[model samples]
Target: MALHPALTPVADLVGTWRGPGRGEYPTITSFTYTEEVTFTDVGKPFLTYLQRTWSPAGDPMHTETGFFRVAGGEAVEFVLAQPTGQTELAEGSLVTEPRGFATELHSRVVNAASAKIVDATIRRLRLDGDELTTEFAMAAVGLPMTHHLGSVLTRTA
Candidate 1:
């Protein structure tokens, strides 16, 4: 099927990517995991996103599902939900580079009563050819915004 015109800017992300990633937070020990991320086009203006991570021993660590859309010009948005009882609305801009694109997103977080307290988050992602690099900062659980995770992944499908 032909790609939606609105999704042209992020067309490169419409595939499965897998690789290693490291995560850390002020409240927990640092650890490494294997991560897989997939972006699928459902014949709509937005792309469906799914991400999952597993520990080195293959235990499931984290997962999230979301929708990504280009909201005209360089503006983009991502609405996501996590099993941890948190939902996030992120808005950002996408800048086209010679190799690919770079995005900087800021998110407003809402947590369920039973969920951990998460106030806000910032994420930066750069896609160059088949490599995807990402960094995230978060404010939560009495901690101010601080680096939380980073990963470099390669297209797997």
Candidate 2:
């Protein structure tokens, strides 16, 4: 299918990426996981996003499904839902670079009554050639905003 014209700034992300990731936070011990993130275009104005992670022992760790949309000009929007009982609406700017593009998205979260408290989150995604680097920061569980996870994934599809 043809790429959406508005997605020109982020066309490079339409593929599957897999790599190892390190996760850390103030409330928990640091850990490492292997992650796979995929972006797909289905003849629409937005790209479908899916991410999953697994432990070294092959245990399922985390997963999120979302949609990525370019909201005119350099603005971008991301809406995602997690099984952990939180949904987020994140918005940010998309900047074009020599290699690809980078985005810094800040999210407003809605948590289910049974979910843990999550104050805020910032997600950063950078594309350089065939490599995509992802970082996540959050303010949650009575702690201030802090670095939570990071990974460098390579395009595989």
TM-score for model 1? 0.98
lDDT against the true structure, per candidate, is 0.93, 0.96
Question: 1-157, model 1: which lDDT tens digit per residue?
Answer: 8889999888998999999999999799999999999999998999999999999999999999999999895998999999999999999999998888999999999999999999999988899999999888999998999999999999999
TM-scores for every predicted model: 0.98, 0.98
- Residue pairs with clashing backbones, model 2: none
Q: Please state the error at residue 35 of candidate 2 in Å.
A: 0.6
Worst-scoring 10-residue span by lDDT in model 2: 1-10
CA shift at 25, candidate 2, in angstroms? 0.7
Best by lDDT: 2
